[model samples]
Target: MSTTVLHARTLPGDAEQRWPARLWGVLAVLCLVVFLDGLDGSMISIALPSVGHDLGMGTASLQWIVNGYYLGYGGLLLLGGRAADMLGRRRVFLIALGVFAAASLLSSVAASGSLLIATRFVKGVAAAFTAPASLSLLTTTFPEGAQRNGALSVFSLFGALGYSLGLVLGGVLDGFGWRYVFLMPVPLALLALVVGWKLISRDRRPRPGRRDHADRGRRRVR
Candidate 1:
């Protein structure tokens, strides 16, 4: 049997019919990361009572498990953006994905509310980096206008659908243990890490513009 092969759209800039196979793979990985991020928050919401029961959490502190994640995620948004710029988007994304996976593993086995909350915070922090980096990477990889718009639509659809699916998944996994909710994302993260590593292109950064020139000019004048 002969199999037909489809070529990928050129990595950003070519308005073409067949997209690069690697581009689709990269999009899947990026969308998976976002999907898991959205799912983690929603899925855990359904498991809170179970978590509280197992961890012996008080009402006051139980809220923090969720809030802790938000705190780390929201607070670090700016820092994560800067990190993607300075640290390199692909490198930062991979590191953050690892952090998210590790934190999920830690969260699954946490013996105390303190530990669980801390792990959630860590996951959220990782998410902060992953979100922007994924978006930046996606846009750059796809061409402007229709191509980028289509990619964004797919990315956002995953995010929206993840929340919906998470609730159902949370209920199903509840039979196993609330820990499964946190534990589940770990595999997805790992898979994304692998796919991303293989498919993500090594991008050359554009040079800094007027800021560098101005500084050099002043230094030379002095």
Candidate 2:
């Protein structure tokens, strides 16, 4: 698959920034990761009424579909945030991306309303982990104020676009079937998964600049 190519090209990271070209590619990939979270929320809203009709659900039952995602996402975000801190951000991010993608796949094919709701909860919980871990990666990567700000601007832009596009996407996809709304995220998720595994640095933290410190100390001594 195309993912195999992505992995082969992305590994053996240039921590020295030897290839600025590759660095940009890596940045774009990470930005794409956070975009998915926003898109999912907006996209599902557009499809919900149709989903309710197709699945034969009442108002109370339909509410649970959205509520379930929020419950899992909101309830466990604190725990997920702590885990991202204690565990490696890269580790949590990759695992969460995998879980989200798997849950989405399962959700798209679910035979019943109950199964769909359960999978949505799983997706939401995974999002909590991925979001914080991704932001951590971004901040760590571009530690300087200017660079970090630029990266954040790009990241936020993607998130905003994802939300705006989701409504249009949901309406289009819903015309075919509500299931396509679940399916919509698959390609984006898979690409992020591949790039996350390959492009995201395993060594995400920066080392202290002992050389600069030494220089300052020498000047002081003189």
Candidate 3:
């Protein structure tokens, strides 16, 4: 009898994939931004009564505050994702997050109902960009495998937790002032922005020639 041995073959793309050394830090930053986006979406709902009373906004005008956010969020969501693909994901995420933070600060000091609603709309647009960019960044950062799946689960958990926690936090912050509800996210956003800039890797744009070649190859394949 002769002894036989077989060698295992490495799958395609297996060699090209690499996980970042600071993956946990990157994931945490992504999660924090996602949580803040979710929190901002719902946090003001509970503070509406206080807002209306303080700002002298009627029920109809107050509704615009909430509607403004949803309008911008839903309207630009698809465009935001496309923007991330064309522009750099890291760049889009950082810019959007910065806008989100600034909008939060402005909302806190908004003198009129119209100004506050506009700030909320801008925040929603920023969230639309950040959400997709962060998700795409997560996928690229963690190679496809169990680790990526686990990271995704954690990321999703934070998003849901934010919305649920927002209602509770809104009530608590409302006790101080309606403005406090808006102010709460400002610090969190700023912290995430700073951390994200440090932790997230820079996007590598393909050289013009390489990109043209890639497009040609894809066209041939199609």
Q: Which candidate's lDDT is highest?
A: 3
Q: What is the lDDT of every predicted structure here?
A: 0.90, 0.83, 0.91
State TM-scores per candidate. 0.88, 0.81, 0.86
Best by TM-score: 1
Residue pairs clashing, model 1: 8-19, 8-20, 9-19, 9-20
Residue 9 error, candidate 3, Å: 20
Ranking by TM-score: 1, 3, 2
Off by over 4 Å in 1: 1-15, 208-214
Per-residue alpha-carbon lDDT of candidate 2 for residues 1-222, written as tens digits (9 for 90 to 100): 999988776764534334376557767877787788888877888888987888887778777878888888788888887888788888898899999999999889987789989999999999889888888888877766666788789999998998899899989999999999998788889888897788778854655599989999999999
Worst 10 residues of 1 by lDDT: 1-10
User: For residue 64, what is the lDDT in candidate 3?
Assistant: 95
- TM-score of candidate 1 versus the correct structure, residues matched by position: 0.88
Deviation in angstroms for 17 in model 2? 12
